[model samples]
Target: MAYSTTIRRRRRTRRIDRAGNPAAIGRWLLFVAGLVALMVVVGGITRLTESGLSIAYWKPVSGILPPLDAEAWQRTFAAYQATPEYRLVNRGMTLDEFKSIFWWEYVHRLLGRLIGLAYGFPLLVLWMRRRIPSGLKPRLLLIFLLGGAQGLLGWFMVKSGLVHEPQVSHYRLAAHLLLAILIFSLLLWTALDLLEPRHGSRQRRWRAMAMVLLLLVVVQIGLGALVAGLKAGYAFNTWPKMGEHWLPPELFALKPFWRNFFDNAIMVQFLHRLNAMLVAGWCLLIAVSTWRFEAPPRTIAAALALLLLIVGQIWLGIVTLVEGVPVAIAAAHQAGAVLVLALTLYFLHMNRRTAHHL
Candidate 1:
């Protein structure tokens, strides 16, 4: 009887150990985050190539397989021809030209499907095995829901272009891009939180600063999305000044005054540049404050890393703008925004962990 009881206890211990495997969960989250990052880069390319409206319909399942034959390709192209994008902008485009644009949108949608599988399959398995921490289950589920919303939002943005106008509504475009960034940020933060072994001493002031910086990073990302949606970068094509003036004459020229922020290309581009400077300044403040306060080694390291990322991202943005938003440089700049946000969130998470312990 005693031997049997001891074996039962050991089995339960093993089950408990397996259920709370931090390394496995952390790695899974990181993998999902990577896919999200790739999706962002691919989405950037799709936007730059003007291929977003190529797919006239959104078939979550059937859409997986692209046009496999000439007939199907013709049908797909026909549907695209019905949309305003083709009618207004791509009029006179040939079948071959249509295929060129179609592939980018196809790959972008395909990546989204792949991300859903990569995230859902592992998540379901973990949940079934009771491996996910009870506290984390709801948060993980929220991320999954947010991912689904992003998919729907993508179609909504495309639909905008399909309707009356040849271009997508900048508002919907910004929403879609910001949602993607938010999802990425959450996944990364959750993974890092789980991976952290223990809490250190909290720096309340530093924590607050990190949180503020994280918010600023997100806002900057939204501004960038606006710039992309408006195709504003193509107009300025200069650094430091917009045609010999810090603020161009066309900036805020729109009626209602506020419309300029979202609808005015010159204003949108100028604001994006302005926000970049603000984010850089905030990052600098954090780095200097970290040194002044003599923050924990980990906090100090995160601050320095955040500063470095901000600098690199700013430089990339300048190059992308100066070069008229070339595909490669613009994509890198978009990815750099992801990296910057990731570091800022990581720093915030670290500080919060310490605060919780205190």
Candidate 2:
């Protein structure tokens, strides 16, 4: 009788360890992930529109309220005039034109603030009620810290343009974008970990492939950011070949040779194209391996879905480039990248969980 009682206690403990109020926590996480997606899309628009440097200040608290009166608007415009972008690029921009860019940056910053509040308040409530699983506390706290760092990193990127150049550094833009994607992926992975079932046999090879695919997707995103930063898409404006050549001649013409990878528009766009090919090839490998090994049904389905999304993403990217990276299509492509990353994380988390069960 005592042995049976101990067995029951252990089962109960395992159940508790799996999750504490998972339904509530998972829902919150999904909501935050959706918001992050919106932020990323809007951020892309802000960059494409060249509105990222309009505000000229990072007022985390007071900047919430946009210029209300005409006098206030003039003051805002005057501040922008002091920056190099105004003198070098937008010298003739009027107040109305200034507002057009101002709102995009404003919305981007507002969304960032909202995400912070949405995440923090609910987290506090859940923690007070003892609804968050103890094992998850540290992970959630780390995500919050990363979120804060992302905000500062964004300002750092903006500060670069404000000082001497009309454009932010491609490196800083890549860092900011990469960090945001990382936070979004982490939230998605944690939420799926909490909500999904934990019973299945693991495939070690498949697990390794999924992780590799995830890392490649992240690197591709960073490359895409660099392409956008350098406005590289507008230069080539062709697919399968960059302006009638398989490899553009001016790719490495920049001084110091290595500067071409980040600063040279031709080289940046070429690298992005090469990286996309690598990512697509990796996805194909994962799909074939999963099917050959006869992995779990969930794993197979995820692998197939990932393959489909990546194919579509590749198509979208080509179209976006062929058409000169139009705002609408480019934003959709950016959002698609996030979705691919989220799905990849889901696959990796599920694979690891299955291994743990085994």
Candidate 3:
């Protein structure tokens, strides 16, 4: 009887350990998401401070440390001066000024590298120990690869401006921003997968609709990056109206219609403005749909939070544009995008939970 009782107790302990493993994975995923958010803010600073083109090379392994001596500094500064961005835009900038922007971009890249390690190392150990379920291992590996691709895309975006444009190409900038959003979305999705809560009382269609709105908002943010890349915000300082008219008369001034959308500042800024309106409308609709659902209070609450974030992001965008996209305001605006994205992801996660519950 004693031996039988001991075996039963051991089995109970094992069941309990396995029961809540998903929540632990959820928490770790949340932590990685937060780290990526920090990387985004740092990246925004690098762009706003005009530091992205400072490094001039992608030395992923050995580029973490900044130059410490005069010789090292001269070599780095000379590399920057060789770039078109330095020769045309910031001609004759002193070493001290170069250092300022250099550190911003350097730190941004360093953090990105660290984040990759932080994610991969622990994930390997967890997998080895069989802590992660077989179903999740593949998904987690894909997330890591996506993160790696994002880092490469970042360098490619920066490289575009270093040749002749004196600024990164808007298309490349948009690609970079989209990649970042993609990484964040995937991370949040993986986190949701780990949390496998039972579906709540909400319909699956409602959840799918919310996910669509969330993706639209992410695409809008990519356009916003184009606006920033071309320094377009500095031109259209007025909100809701682009310099007295709802749309600029010279929208198609560029030679080809396609050129206007890709190369013309007026068109890029207009698209970003129009997208904001669409995002707001969709957010409100999602919030209303979620409100009418008979789901857990937290699920509905996440939807409401998402609505508020969208509203706040629009307001921040206006302020940043009006203020000439000052470094701090611009950084805040970028950070706000991440915040709204996170909340939207959180709502989608809850929606998935609701679906499972049913």
My TM-score estimates for the predictions, one after another, are 0.93, 0.92, 0.89
Best model number under TM-score:
1
Tens-place lDDT digits, model 3, residues 8-80: 9999788556444887887788789888889889988988888888999989877877788999999999999
Q: What's the lDDT for residue 252 in model 3?
A: 92
Q: What's the ranking of the predictions by TM-score, best on top?
A: 1, 2, 3
lDDT of each: 0.88, 0.87, 0.81
Deviation (Å) of 249 in candidate 1: 2.5
Write model 1 residue lDDT over 85-183, tens digit each, in one string. 888888999999999999999999999999999999999998988888777888899999999999999999999888898899889999999999889
Candidate 1 structure lDDT: 0.88
lDDT of 2 by residue, 256-326 (tens): 98888778989888988998889889988988888998877777899999999999999999999888888
In order of lDDT, best first, we have 1, 2, 3
How far off is model 2, as Cα RMSD? 3.0
User: Looking at candidate 2, what is the lDDT of residue 305?
Assistant: 95
Supply candidate 2's per-residue lDDT for 352.
76
